[model samples]
Target chain A: MRITSETVADGIREQLFTIGDIPGVLWTPAEGSGPRPLVLIGHGGGSHKKGWEVVSRAFPYVTSCGFAVAAIDAPGTGDRPEHPEIRRLVALTQEREAAGEPFWSGPEWPALNETVAAQLIPDWQTTLDALRKLDSVGDSRPVGYYGLSQGGEMGIRLVAAEPRITAAVLGLVGSDWLTETAARVTIPVEFVLQWDDEGSPRDSVMKLFDALGSAEKTLHANPGSHFRVPSFEIDSSIRFFARHLGGPGTASGS
Target chain B: MRITSETVADGIREQLFTIGDIPGVLWTPAEGSGPRPLVLIGHGGGSHKKGWEVVSRAFPYVTSCGFAVAAIDAPGTGDRPEHPEIRRLVALTQEREAAGEPFWSGPEWPALNETVAAQLIPDWQTTLDALRKLDSVGDSRPVGYYGLSQGGEMGIRLVAAEPRITAAVLGLVGSDWLTETAARVTIPVEFVLQWDDEGSPRDSVMKLFDALGSAEKTLHANPGSHFRVPSFEIDSSIRFFARHLGGPGTASGS
Candidate 1:
């Protein structure tokens, strides 16, 4: 892992780093030195590691909980070089959408996600391995994943495959294809759903929530469209992770 | 309102009171005086004002948020004298259950709820009027309501009728009769649902949630039976009420 740039602001240290070809960003309390619980955030489709959604959650995880938070560009997002297949699939879906047709009804939607997962999932594993080696985010601490929408789509698959993730706050995507993968996730989960989400229907979102194998899963649904998740949910996630991963001043962490 | 008894424990002041023929209890921070946000807790079926469910939530609203909390006996429960009609209906339902039949399938279920709501709703309004007259619980402060199951049934009615209540946390009920009443409630609500609930099916609970008129309503669903709502939800309620009613130390309250 190579950190190409580092900056500090508002009591948080932000580091832009690269592991092979994957680009990522990490945030931690500026004053802390040793290991702390780390939360990996996955951005939504068309968004990158430093997107508003990722930064909004990362800031609180670092400043309030004194935890390490990281986000990485997916196969063709952020600073990563473009992939031909991903670009082609996204363009097809966008064109379908532009023509006043439902883009998600087409095969390209799932195909695009599959292509991204093929490379992004392995990239995430490599990033996690490198992150754990850092003194500020050692392997001893608990790990959590937070993602919504496309992030939630990939999160179900990643959390199911990655044993290192002990807990997750995921939702906003409910493709039928992820049902079996959701069942393999037995760790504690806090699933979110937008009651009026246009892209992801409430029933499908709930079906995914129901498929989760976690004994300690909670679903929080609010009335809103796909992009209008209430701000209070962010506070709820902080408490969820704090309960499962242990906050900085709490007994569970340093 | 007449105070029958008063006690202080664990930094909470508990007062047993009676307004006319209605028996009730109130809890508040033992250290402070003057008006604060008041949360009226409605107890579950076959339970009374001081039942475990009521006391558990009451204590936190008092000690944690420094809010005044209160609960009242339903028409046929607690210290209130029993009515023959309520007793007869309950006996019939209990007999049906003992016969390995679903008691809720019978007309006796709705009849029992209707019988209780007729008297209990008026009693709650009277108690609220009397409580607001107290020096420590003046009329100016915001009022919130918390109840589930039977309490939820009564709460949906009361909140719909009572303009004084500004927020509520209600759920665990989905009586078909309450849909119209639920729509009249426009305040912010944090509705709770217990998945796999034997008495309240998940779909019914969610349907009621959908009927709510409140634009700011949220649903928290956890995987458990009727009686197994996770303890974390209690903490979540504290935050919910604290946000809407304004905790004692916060700018929204004293």
Candidate 2:
């Protein structure tokens, strides 16, 4: 875990770091005395680790409640070098969209998306391993995850495979390609769905929530497009995480 | 290829035989002499070799047009044993559909479909190798393929890998998840598309047709549902095969 740069602002400590070749960010409460509960944020497709800047603003409130937050760019997003095949797909998608054509449902979309998502699961898992070793972070801290769109899609697999993630907030995603993975997730989950999402149909999104195997899961559906998630729902997600990670919210070793 | 059973029905000689473990059937004009152009047919998902019966009725007409037609069951269909995983998926699809739900867009659909399609390409190729060695069949014959839905999907892979297939009629199927394979197909192709297909959205189907690398390709679009393709289109397909494989269409080795 190598810290490339560090800054302290308004009593919040932020650092840009790398785990081997992976670029990431870690934000911790500056005035905290000991280890604190940690939350890992995931950004959507084409976004980087800092794609959560506005969401990171909300993290200050989380840190105020005694927790740390961290995130890394998915492969081909952020500071990570772009995958060649995904780069070609991005170019093709743009070319089609510019020509007033459909892109997401095109012939190559499913295979390309699968290729990218397959790379994301292990990228996140390795980042989690490194994040666990930082100062004020501990092995026993109850870790949680928050991501939307691509993040939410891959987060299903992340949460299921990583026993450390006790709870997760996955939003703006459906379970179409990941049904078997969704069925394997037994952690507490807060899944947000957009009722009128054009990308993922309403019924499919509902079916996704239905497919989750978690005994304790909640659906926070808002009547909006895929991009405009209601702010109130965001508040509700914070509260959901707080309830799950609030008490004794300290990392074990720090 | 040993002919296990030979029967004369309605002036068509139907012979059932096995090429090693692969079971198949051949249909030719009962009264014809010498070799004829050969056409290979592929069955769809959850359907066996006999699934071509309706098409076979049409095949007798094709045999009357100076061609021999044959079909073999795809993996997990007909005489081939049902793959345990696909059997589970079929049960799950049925269970969901029986509950007034959408099974095809669910999470397991892509993975299940891919598993079946992957097994189909080699299966069809091996059957082709055997069919080529039969008495009325010739190694140098100009071969064509006809398949819809799952068969259409896997046929893309077969036509690309098996240079023996000089032409094909891939109908009522959209080209997602197989665009790479579709791009590799450079032979003459006659693709069918439905204007209002509930299963395959029009734009995606159009995009799939656009992705084909064939220098000489034609799209036959008609306004119909996925299942209700007009009979006239079927006649057009037979004519297309007849032109590509009839009369002077002599196998290179015959």
Candidate 3:
């Protein structure tokens, strides 16, 4: 990975880097005495390394809690140029959405999903490989993963394939394709579920949760739309990761 | 089917009707002395009974050739009320399209495509059933099918299921899912293929044509984009349908 920029902000040292062809960011507590636990973030579709709007908001809180955060743009979004086929689809989607249209009920969704899955899983693994080699994050540094929606959907594959990730926070990602991946994830997990997600039905969400193979997993659910995750719930996820990755007595990392 | 409007212009009589819940239109020679051959039309995605602009432009010519023509809005388009799921999908498609975004490189396209296929084929069959009963049509009317792009993609299923369709003109649609459907379509076919379709690669289009089960089928290929079917090709399709559905010497139905 090649570092492109480095800056200090609010007691955090943030660096922009590229791992192979994938662009990413590293955020760590500037005053930490030793190597801190590392958290890899997966941004959703139409999002970038900064983790989209919702995800970007969490970087500061997670970093202040004494952990390093790293995130890369999902394959077709952010700094990575979108594939030509994907570019066409995004244009069509935007045109239809502007007309107040829906997208899921057609036959194209499944194929598009497959294309995206094929593109994302490898990048997630590559990002993880590059992050673990950085000076701020040694090979043995405890690694955690946090992703929701597109992030969570793809993170399942990453966590299942990479055993180095000690824990993961997965949310708003529910699909039958995850059944096998969920079964392979033995890491500590805190899965977030929103009850009324039009994009992802509740039953599918529950089915994904039910399929997780983790021995130590918790289900944190709320009754709201998929994008409406409450701050308290977000804190719970932070606490969950802190307990597992930041060592005991570090739950409040502050 | 319930006829709602009837008008005659330039020797063609056009009747607007509803087959079950699907809004449709019937075009026939106003001077036809008896029940002429019938050709059912399947409009493309985001289009209605009138067909997309391209297909609509061909209607009078086809009707003038001594054949009755019928077309209905595919599920979620045209006069038919869009399915709630479809509406959401269309809105999303529009939103993504307008943003110059890429969508299908993601996983959603396949699922949405299946939903559209499931909805369209049955509606096509139902419309066919209702169309045959019209006094202006009659039970023994020789039947043919015509569809392009979204129309052609979904028409494979309809033609395979509806044996009464003696022939079909399908083009500008190419997907692996059509392999099995194409294998089941035994009717005489005049398949159209555009060489430079960004939406449908040439190899896939040729593969679909090669997969057709028909003993007597022809490929009418041209060098153009998907939406730019040449006028001569349209005439060739008209003649093919005439040879299969209308009597000999009726190729020029003028």
Candidate 4:
């Protein structure tokens, strides 16, 4: 069989936005076309949008097989300006780490202003709405998301709260956040669990899966740690969005 | 309860390791008391040892709770010898992806050279002998191995080839290798599977677990993708190692 030349060129392109007074950077793909299924991503604790490059570059290899991906640095990471909520989160984390609280030993640094919680759900909504509004991305595509660690929580909340997400990939995090944000969601979800993830253990995923009000669900477990980033994980994320998101490359029927 | 800062510091520290063949950078942690259980980790295809920094460094965090950890990066990737086998594996991937042939996916990776194949079992032995011979790791402690993707296959082979491995962690790889290498292992094993991994999905893990010869075994499934590395994966890797591999920081008594 003759080999196909599948060209894959990737980069971090961005748009600036504000979550209230806090300035934020929307990290997205440079080569998106046709209503590329948007991928609104969030970063984990202590990290920002910079942590998302792995997915942005990798999704195209698979997602590009059919969709466009966009990731946003949470309020504090990357070029985004720090919000007052971030300050509160830091202060709370310090106090907890000082008190040597058990949660410190667990994942999640801290979120001081619970209102940031309210703003959090809208981050993806705002991005997806904007992406759909983009001239390049008209009304023909379904948006999706992939998040890791702390971002995993954000991704789950977004899809659960908004119907815009046709599909979603949650890596190393859980949907427990939905108890407050989304009581139920209809989209098909793919969950990627890291076997030895300390930040969010197996218990978290199990609990979250049980809470999922949706019936369309899939799960994959691979032996890995939070620190190890490799191509395999990238491949999975790409394949996932390719399956769920609607794009010129992937027909809604596919 | 007054929490000790030392414990927290140690818990967070196992996650750190010196990368590359910087002569000084070995898996051995800074001087600690007594000999600890040893583990040699190898990475999946198209990757190297240092390639696992994201996954392997947290071994110490597990160690702080008290078992020493070392992430093994096989020849090639993150500073290992460019062995012929590694070269072939890379070539196969490039060719297959270019071929764009759907059949050329999953564990269909070309076989390791007979030399590499024959040594799979012994390579681990050599690693153990080398570790035991090290000034830092003595023979007083037990040893085990853990691997992911391609590494997962190797971990099983290593344990199956050598009884030195008291426990093994296998994730997202072919289960047949266990059947091929079953006689060699006689330790506890943990298998993690994602419900919808693009490659080796959930059924694969159950098959591997069912075929395994170990008297002590457990199967864990998570909602995740092959690409989305999870926090639980890291937590489990470290926890498994800490329990099987004896050292100072890990919680003992498994």
TM-score winner: 1
Residue B25 in candidate 1, Cα distance off native in Å = 0.5
TM-score of 1: 0.97
TM-score of the A chain in candidate 3: the value is 0.88
Candidate 1 lDDT over residue span B1-254, tens digit each: 88999998998889999988999999988887777889999999999999999988999888788899999999889899978999999999999889998777789999999999999899889999998998778788899999999999999999999999999999999888889999999999999999899888899999999999999999999998999989999999999999998856333232
TM-score of chain A of 1: 0.97
The candidate that wins on DockQ is: 1
TM-score of 3: 0.47
Instruction: Please give each candidate's TM-score.
Output: 0.97, 0.48, 0.47, 0.47
Candidates sorted by TM-score, best first: 1, 2, 4, 3
Q: Which portions of model 3 miss their true places by more than 4 Å?
A: A1-254, B52-58, B61-63, B91-104, B248-254
Candidate 3 residue lDDT tens string, B70-119: 88777777777748877777667667666776443334455667788787
lDDT of 2 by residue, B1-254 (tens): 77889988766778888777677888776764555667788777767776753355346545546577888877677787757888888888778777887666676677777777677777778887777776576665688888777768777878989998998988566757777778898887877766568777766765676678886666655545777665644655676676677662443221
| Tens digit of per-residue lDDT, candidate 3, span A134-158 | 6566666688888888778878888
- What ranges in model 4 sit over 4 Å off? A1-33, A52-63, A98-100, A104-113, A174-183, A246-254, B1-254
DockQ for all models, in order? 0.96, 0.01, 0.01, 0.07
TM-score for model 2?
0.48
Better of 1 and 4 by TM-score: 1
Q: Model 2 off-target regions past 4 Å?
A: A52-58, A96-102, A248-254, B1-254
lDDT tens string, model 1, A1-254? 99999999999899999999999999988885777899999999999999999999999988888899999999888999988899999999999999998778899999998999998899889999999999888888899999999999999999999999999999999899999999999999999999999799999999999999999999999998999989999999999999899866333233
